[model samples]
Target chain A: MSDTSRTPTEVDDAALIERARREPEAFAEVFRRHAPEIQRYVTRRLGADPAEDVVADTFLAAFRQRERYDLSRSSARPWLYGIATNLIARHKRIEVHQLRVLERTGTDPVSDPFTERSDERLSARSVRQRLAAALASLPAGHRDALLLVAWGGLSYQEAAQALGVRIGTVRSRVNRARNKMRKELGGVDPTSSISEVHVRG
Target chain B: MDEMTQLDRLRSEIPTPELSGAAERRLLAEIATSSQPRPARRQRRRVNLGLGLASGLAAAVTMGVVITNGDSGDPGQTPTVQPYSMAAVTLQRAADNTSKQEELHPKPGQFLVFESQTMDPVDSNNENGHSRFLSRSKRTVWLPVDGSSLDGVLFMEVLPPKPYPGWPLPPEAKQEVGTRGPDRLADFDQRAEYLRTDYAYLSSLPTDTAGMRKHLYLELEPGARADYEAWDRVGSMLAEGYLPAAQRAALFRAAATIPGVETVKKSEDAAGREGVAVAMVSTEAGERQEYIFDLKTYQYLGQRTVVVDADKAEAPVGSVLTATALLKVSVADSAPVVNGG
Candidate 1:
């Protein structure tokens, strides 16, 4: 994993975790390494306000459980992601509510600031709305599986590890979730239309 | 044009946020606290060492009130003025004396400088399990007259560590025996506005007894917890807080009316100045929170927490868990230059 591929002088996550067990101050390094990505993931899911709380709590919980970390996995990404996913699960209602709002309004509250002047935003509105509707309608477990694979960029194996599910379960959930999204989009290639609009623009 | 690609395009513009500095500091503080060793057995009592800033005190004050069975008498009942109660008499005298004392008037551009000494429990762990000791320090704080705790500057010098009554002093205890920074006191101040101790806020407080009593119980749920919280508020205000003589007198008068207050004829501050004290017992923690006063002058001396029940407090009876003596309070035009700036 990219996280484990550190420079020769740098210590890996496992060594940092071991050091933190003795001198708790070393845990600050772990936070400094991954806080940005974790904060972004949580903000994407739960907006800005609750993301602050969830991200802080995730790191604190991770620090408390550092002694139990499996050192065999050199990368702390999966472990940290798993902890964040669990904390995000507590805000399931907020996530679904946000998605439903986007689906109905065709305006993503979470992405408004970033897409305010983007060239492709207006052209891709319908596709974004359909995707939001499909995502909001899926079973939470399936949505978790699909997003862990898609947005989180976790491999199926890593997704399974993060969600504490069997690899087959993650595979089936992602397949089912994709089928549902395809049906919601009327079996059309939504991304193709957006890219075509982008070409014309 | 797979579903996964379409999903990725949705809300893909949501930028990655910078982790908030406040959240980072809170996490670091939590880690520092957890690094300290705690008792092997679960601690039923909440100890308010009043060690850090007001944010820490706000949380400790809230948790210090543990609900006890029937002993609280009736919940939410307004405490009747027990004119003959020794605590009430002593507090009234203190109020009279406070009203006559000269008060410092800090302006908005100036600062309120507070100097004090404190002793609080310090716990740590290593290959050997948890170890506990008392960490003593002398602190001088320069707080802006009209600003949040974030604007405050603190300078602390660590004193030699003492054994926590029965516990042995660990070798690591002496590691921090030196002077620390005149750094920022708090990274963030999430304390509610009513809990503010800045000179500007304190000056705006009501200067009448009934109004002060009502302020003490502001937003507090009606019950024994409210009474204890009101008492805690008084301590927070008196510690590192300077008020005008009018408000100060009203505070003492209002504090006397809190339920469960009693008189301790003899009490000693962290500075070892023996004085009379007004105290309230937290039956849950089995400790009495005392606010000491000079016997003859009736001047406010300091505050301390003494164990009243060994089993519940996890310490011998009369063991002092934490103590503080407010050495001085003065007005300063500016804080000393820190970091050579």
Candidate 2:
């Protein structure tokens, strides 16, 4: 009865999406609540210059396709990531090339050493370079699955749903990708400070 | 470098670019105004030149509703910036000549083997505060050309600096090795990835010269704007990265268009490789980066950084910061094994 000035945080993504289906103005609240994180995720994959367009395209696509979103999923993170991956794939050559560059250089193209702290935990430049090379060498589907879980914070099932793959496929893809990385990188210490950094989107 | 450390770094160290406050507001404002549904029509590519960065994404939302309904134009084009001219002619010539070289396609199992004398400034403290000394050492690295489970490459020290015997090792490395003497060569793990190069990424560069310029110049502004060295960055990338044939040519062509490019008809590099050179001097930094190429083949010989002004570099003029000379690049079936024992 007292739903007049409900905050975006009070409700879930699915509920907000359902409301936007009727009163599309309400969709702006959805953008306000999650745009920063979504924008950050896209920026992690694409550099800032292209991230601007990606963030814009992602929300607009989400807005237009709001009706098709499954109401069962409480959180929209997976759906948003799926769309972000789709837009990223639309520029596949550039994406892969950028990944390769990151891998070869042992440094993120987006990282500005002046404003940001150099990750001393990175164990020097050579190791980071190897990791980048390993990541760049991964199969597209496998990389997507691994990244969806590791970077996107999606569960295996959620990743499966995001990539439109079976749970088994997701498991294998993630396993194969992780194993390859471990083999190339030497057995990684999962408890390291670096692994703990991906707590957010 | 250890593999696990690298993986951890990849997860944490990579910096993510941030969204500007105005960008978020602009998107939200558009959404606030265009909430009303409109008649559906053929989606044409709409580009708002006023906002170059957001035009592509804004187009999607603007199309279905009454957003940016003003400039209704054709579909699929974003407004692009104009190109500036510099010493791109020399770069294009170099690229063209390099591209014409017989392409050496390596099978997946092979490695890209290179031998080089890497010269870096090794700063040491003695009775007299500190001094920067150039240390030249020979290094040979075998990098896997294929993404294979072999999961390893080889790094070897061919020659240790002898005259002044200087190879700076981290205190941790010194403690780990428990050695004060510079023997240089040592048996290493098979999984060591001492050399990192991605051929896959090289071919992915913009085939068109203009596209290459756009990609580099736009990205360079936020990073190198202080020294007006964006073109130099592009030139350095071309000189350093092993770009594919077409893209390499395109990069050279693009470099020709950069501003303030200077050429020296004859120059001898640190390694004494005789070649013609192209350079860019950063007035503020009082340093210059020169990329030397063979006169006959225009093949990249090496690159070096030299101080042009003492006040800027905070060192004596003519001091060399870094230098590297490429010796040989070839695809080998496997790394040449040496018995360290």
Best by TM-score: 1
Fnat of model 1, as a fraction? 0.58
> Distance (Å) between predicted and true CA of A180, model 1?
51
Poorest 10 consecutive residues by lDDT, candidate 2 chain A: A192-201
lDDT of 1 by residue, A128-158 (tens): 7778888899998898889888878888888
Candidate 2: Cα lDDT at B56: 11
Runs in model 1 deviating more than 4 A are: A1-201, B1-84, B126-128
Model 1 chain B poorest ten-residue lDDT run: B58-67
TM-score of the A chain in model 1: 0.89
Best by lDDT: 1
Over B1-341, each residue of candidate 2 has an lDDT whose tens digit, in order, gives 33433443453544543545555444443333221121011011111111111111111111111111112211122212122332455566788797668776766677665555445433332222222333344444454565431232334232222111122332322222221212212112111121112445455668887887775565233544422444544533433235667877877776666666667554445456766667666665565556668888988777655556644443445544455576667777876553331
For candidate 2, give the DockQ. Answer: 0.09
- Give lDDT for model 1: 0.71
The residue pairs found clashing in candidate 1 are: B37-B123, B37-B124
